[model samples]
Target chain A: MNGISAEQLNQAHQADLAIQSEEGVVFEHAWADPDEGVIYCLSDAPSAEAVMRIHQRAGHPADEIHAVPLEV
Target chain B: MNGISAEQLNQAHQADLAIQSEEGVVFEHAWADPDEGVIYCLSDAPSAEAVMRIHQRAGHPADEIHAVPLEV
Candidate 1:
């Protein structure tokens, strides 16, 4: 997330996409602002740990993962 | 984005929701980490500026906005 470029972020996304289903996670989408030293991933997974684990395996562990509210 | 609490974030979200339709934005979902001093919004809007202008009007302008990748 920090000191990374858009190209690197997408590279990591591709890596996660390669192994996500085996991890019981769906790589829905990602957003990042390298200027802010952060990347955000939105996914369908049972747990935040599952999401984190996938990213770790992909060599892109998330800085934080929060379940988003689906409705107001 | 900084020095704000979850309650305040929700308050801002509600404000945006009140005027989003007219602003040409659909408030899809939102995520925040008060500890990180950041809030992330996922919406269907014409442009990032549209998103920002709405939030600005709501008094919680976004710090950064990026078009997320839909596919690898």
Candidate 2:
């Protein structure tokens, strides 16, 4: 999603929440760079695919995902 | 940054912290998707430019930044 507005992101986020349970996904937070048209979402899921599926059903299919097994 | 490793992100985070105070920036958390060549960092700063300055000084210049005035 390039140059997406906060309103649009909020709508997509709501959709994700509506169906995330089916995929055992819990979206925790999301960050959007409307000027850059970049979005970063954090979620708790069994796998990246699960996260992808939720977004897809939510009408904002993720371009890609990465596993973050470690953090500071 | 593309295909950036977790280690790399951590190092960058450290660098950000080292000089963030100079720019009134505090980086809280960071997520890296090595497979997708993406990284997401959360920070509290005076402005998007302040955030960019910190990252730039840390050697990982942000491609763009967006204000998240609202969240769920």
Candidate 3:
């Protein structure tokens, strides 16, 4: 995972807050490392690309998107 | 991030459920990508090392720990 940048954080933060308007997805949570330019997000979506699409649409393409099966 | 394995997952799962016995830390959530061998964890602790220490003691040391100033 690449470090998150402030630009990415701003975009992700906005995306998380605004994602309810999107389809086939709901942004659950986001983690940012401003110094490392890495952004991690948790979301309910059909596929990894769906999550990336949301971020791309929000003007922040993720460095990588891995499926995380939540176990909590 | 390195991928998570079944063995690591079991350790982390048990650790999550058993962390209440530890000090200065609270396991909030865990996400595992079993196929990719990556495990992401969210926890409340005084520092990143606190989270790692708990995991290390639990027998599944995390590959990375990033501070996420959660907004929701």
Candidate 4:
């Protein structure tokens, strides 16, 4: 799939918001293989905007920021 | 940070074996926000042990599996 389904995207967005609210800045992130069509991320900042800035500075902006719940 | 400092978890396990050798069965994944730690993922299942058996049947079993690189 070239793009994720709307429902999936919504879930991802919600997760992102949750993370942003908690973390503040996100500095790392990634997306799935096109064939598989998914997304993920990690960050070191305190805000989502900061994370986005990092991506922009790195010359690779993110398409989405997914909230990853850790087992640890 | 609760964890995630050993060279950023070895570049997130080398991007999770390069997305499990190009998407082999990763249902979905995420990690981070632990005081700005880092990790992320997304999948639809093709390999990686069927995305680790869908996280051991969705019971939450994933210490790490991050290789998210997407800009589209």
Candidate with the greatest TM-score versus the true structure: 2
- TM-score for each prediction? 0.61, 0.77, 0.75, 0.33
User: Highest DockQ among the candidates is held by which one?
Assistant: 3
Please state the Cα-based DockQ of model 4 relative to the true two-chain complex: 0.18
Q: Model 4, range B1-72, lDDT digits (tens) per residue?
A: 356554554455445545453435643443454455544445655455666655545444566543333432
Q: How far off is residue B48 in model 1, in Å?
A: 8.3
Model 1: how far residue A63 lies from native, Å: 1.4
Worst 10 residues of 4 chain A by lDDT: A26-35
How high is the TM-score of chain A in each model? 0.84, 0.92, 0.68, 0.39
Pitting candidate 2 against candidate 4, the one with the higher lDDT is: 2
Clashes (N, CA, C under 3 Å) per candidate: 0, 1, 12, 19
Tens digit of per-residue lDDT, candidate 1, span A1-72:
446776787798889888888868998887765655667778888888999999899887777787653323
Residue-wise C-alpha lDDT for candidate 2, range B1-72, written one tens digit per residue: 666766778888899999999989889988776665667778888999999988887788887577765454
- Each candidate's DockQ score against the native complex? 0.24, 0.41, 0.43, 0.18
CAPRI verdict (incorrect, acceptable, medium, high) for model 3: acceptable
Ranking by TM-score: 2, 3, 1, 4
Q: Which has the better DockQ: candidate 1, or candidate 2?
A: 2
lDDT per residue, candidate 3, A1-72, as tens digits?
355555656665676558744658777767666555456777888888777777787777777788876454
> What TM-score should be assigned to candidate 4?
0.33
The true-versus-predicted C-alpha distance at residue A41 of model 4, in Å, is 3.8
Q: Write the number of the candidate with greater lDDT, choosing between 1 and 3.
A: 1
* Docking category of candidate 1: acceptable
Per-residue alpha-carbon lDDT of candidate 4 for residues A1-72, written as tens digits (9 for 90 to 100): 346555554455445545453436543443444446545445556555666755555444677654444532
Highest lDDT, which number?
Answer: 2
Fraction of native contacts (fnat) of each candidate: 0.19, 0.38, 0.45, 0.33
Residue-level lDDT of model 2, residues A1-72, one tens digit each, is 667777888888899999999999999988776665668788999999999988887788888677765565
